[model samples]
Target: MQRPQTVVFTDLDGTFLDHETYQPGPALEALEELLAVGVAVYFCSAKTRVEQQAIANEFRVDVGFVVENGAAIYATAGAATVFGMPYAQVREALHNAAAACGAAVRGYGDMDVAEVMEHTGLDERRAQYARQREFTESFVIESGEPYELSQAMGELGLRLQRGSRFWTAQGEHDKGMAVRHVTTQLGPNAESFGLGDFDNDLEMLTAVDTPMLVQQHDGTWRDLHVEDMVRLSGIGPVGWCSGAELVLRRHNAR
Candidate 1:
């Protein structure tokens, strides 16, 4: 029997891409090697479809992606498999949740490109891409703990997820669900690897066969306690380099 095809599901902003420069840096070589071997590198990220698709196109990769914190998955065939509410519904739900909890919140739908750039420091092009969201509403709470907000959203059957920069409100579907869906389509010939650097990455990390934590920008790990997890001892894309090489090592051995 043929060996299972390797697949990597990764977070983007502070994992595969450098937080400051937003480039792959040292992970480029390993990414190339993986692609050379036909490994699918699905970018499971908080980014929107436009942003993720731009990256895939820029890198010349044909691998599908999970976008908007698993609100949708793009299969290798270029068909989108959406798993949750539409943008208008999600935005309305967030507003209702915030009002119900009396919490002050500002989501991307409430912000223009200038405001988004101000909050995120993304360039004009990236800011435009961010605004093209379809499923999740990324926001910030100007108030205190999100406990009340979480409860409020939960009442409406939505989940509040925290990313490295923002909190996103979407349906109950998560990265793990999206990854599982993709792998299921790949049948039994799938060996999955996951890499992340923040608390929001917990679901995706736990769903994969090999879960690796990339070092955070502050030189610390994400503090997740996944079983048999590997902590790559480098920061941002530097740690991503370690993870990519490790995946290559395993792939070559197989």
Candidate 2:
């Protein structure tokens, strides 16, 4: 039997983190363990690069990361490379898109980093902690159809990614593309696993050999690809962590 070396990529919110509080549970420990055993851990998130970096720092692991829904890729310890649209173009297109749709646009760089906590109703302590670090530019808009947003972003030479919560301007990037990019950098033979729990995660989940879904309390799992899926009996981060352990155990046995 061939033992496949695995790399794990996870989405942040509504998957690993509690959707309401943004807290990590037992699944976080499983992630650390995976890292200890040399399975690469990467974060593929709708978060801005700044937000992702703060979380990565908390993990104390130099994992590769894909941010802005695949608009940018950052080396664990080096420069961040843009894979989608340039920042300026994304800004302009987002402004126009917001105007057309009567929506508001918020950029990580435009407001004080503290504003995220206020806007999203995140904890103030978390916001303060985040403010202490350098942040990457991220933008959010509330309007436009998914395809329309995608096309306009494309015209600006950037990628628009739609996630569970919001639409963001990163560049022309998606979680699927980010997964492929990281895999390519790690070499072709590395086995990969993807974990997520929402519509935006579909592409990444489909791209990996072992895809896990973090079950939610509202029976959202029923609407996803449940066939052959390894369901976590728990909810939030605990369920995600449970699912990861199961996947790791199964992988090791093979």
Candidate 3:
């Protein structure tokens, strides 16, 4: 039988990047190896296209990426095909939800660069890139229970994704949808591996042939069950490398 094509999907913030430094760290070498072997590595993250674009340039990679928690997918050098509600409509809905629920919600669209930097610890320039959102709005609820906020979002035909620090309001599309879409496009015989380290990655981590949960900076793992999924030891890029090497080895052996 022919060996299946190998494809890797990785989360950015706390999977491919160091949770604290935001550097690729050990995953850098692994990424180079993957690219050297012509294996496709696609970044899957809640980050904006601007942010992922810069990362793609830095890595010298052109493989398509899923951005904003799969709100959209941008093929290499192609126009973005969005699967979720547009940012303008989501923002408007959020405002209405906040007003109706009397919740003190602060979304990325509502904050200035300074505020974003303060809240996210990203430098001013990176914060500016993050603010270039197109399909999803990440916000924090300061005065309302998370359940209440989720209920409000549900009533508006939206959903809330609970991240480690914030909640994202978006349409029904998620990383799983994007992953499946891309992999199916590659071929029915392609093999997929997904790596992630947070709640936001739940759907993605479960939607792959090889799901990998990386250790967190705090030495914990996201509580999710995926049959036959691999749990890597190292955190962030360290775990990313370990998992990549393992999967690639298996692929090569086949």
Q: Give TM per candidate.
A: 0.92, 0.77, 0.92
**Candidate 2 residue lDDT tens string, 130-169:** 3332222345664445566556555655555544444456
Q: Mind sharing the TM-score for model 2?
A: 0.77
Model 3 scores worst on lDDT over the 10 consecutive residues at 56-65
The residue-level lDDT of candidate 3 at 177 comes to 96
Q: Which ten residues in a row have the lowest lDDT in candidate 1?
A: 56-65
lDDT string, candidate 3, 132-224, tens digits: 999899898888777777788788978888876788899889999999988887788888899999877888888888999899999888788
**Better-scoring candidate (lDDT), 2 or 3:** 3
lDDT of 1 at 115: 96
Model 3 lDDT, residue 149, Cα = 71
Rate residue 21 of model 3 by lDDT.
82
How high is the CA lDDT of each candidate model?
A: 0.88, 0.68, 0.86
